[model samples]
Target: MASTTIQRSAARTEVEGAARTERPRGAIAFGLTRIAIGWLFLWAFLDKAFALGFATGRAEDGSIDFFAKGQAWLNGGSPTEGVLRYATKGPLAGFFQSLAGAAWVDWVYMLSMLLIGGALVLGVATRLAAVGGAIWMALFYLATSIWPEYNPVVDEHIVYILVLVGLAQIGAGRYLGLQERWERSALVRRFPVLR
Candidate 1:
């Protein structure tokens, strides 16, 4: 009887260990997704800040420089102007356009891009980043009007918002991000919402 009890206890322990070690389906996929999205935001920040020529640079050869000659933000390139003047369309078009190139707008846009990208990439403060990203995407969605021409009534911005929300809900950062350590920090312990 004693041996049977010990064997049963050992078996249970093994089962629990296996369960603990088993990762959920798609955990890796979700982690990759998080990384990809994080890069998306980060890349935008890099491109806009340096005018790396993907969207905001000029080349001496009069060709679109995919790698050089950007109108750096520090050197006085208005990232908001192009979006406001060309991409914006809808009820807020005029309002957004008017605010384009404004000092406050530039600061807010640059800051949000950096913060959101950093948070997502590091897997820290992801919930806050998701919220901010969703808000930013929502504004873009509304500005673009979700038109069929641009998108079939659903676009990249909307997809990004959903993905950001999912990343926050699943704590994707915990799988491969700094979320595990972040959650253990005193600040997170006191304010669970940070998780």
Candidate 2:
């Protein structure tokens, strides 16, 4: 039993030593970056839902209107219609255009943005969120920004996907997020992939 006691003490010492050590470099910055990207998605969901005069809340004359009720999703606005129908270009234009203004499409896109943004911000289900966000960005990339004058390929969408993949692979949620607590949950413990 002495050997067992000694081993437990050694493990405790190691854990204590790790706790006293400095945080890994860029840990906080990584978490902040995750939150920022998450907010980007969250803000899009908010702006589209409320027509807060940024991208969604615009008058017919192209003027910004803070209270453009008709432009908001909550007020009958179609979030996917404008881009899917008019803005989609390139070879996939027809495919994307075919999906324009569909209520289900709008619902899916809006809900995805909310889920991804909320997950990233809260640092819960980050891996799933990252994957979902990356796929969503890919769809947007294919829908509109497939062809840019600046380059043959590569754009903000691609960059965002890469960042998301990185965040997921690194478990960025654990850094400043509730992921540690989430990981200990019964559901997450049973379904490790959800972590």
Count of clashes, each model = 1, 0
- RMSDs, each prediction? 4.0, 3.9
Measured with C-alpha atoms, the lDDT of residue 194 in candidate 2 is: 84
Q: lDDT of all the models against the reference?
A: 0.79, 0.89
Q: Candidate 2 residues 83-130, lDDT tens each?
A: 898889889999999999889999999999999999999999999999
Q: Where is model 1 more than 4 Å wrong at Cα? A: 1-22, 60-70, 150-152, 190-193
**lDDT tens digits, residues 148-187, model 1?**
3665678888888899899888778866788888989999
Worst 10 residues of 2 by lDDT: 16-25
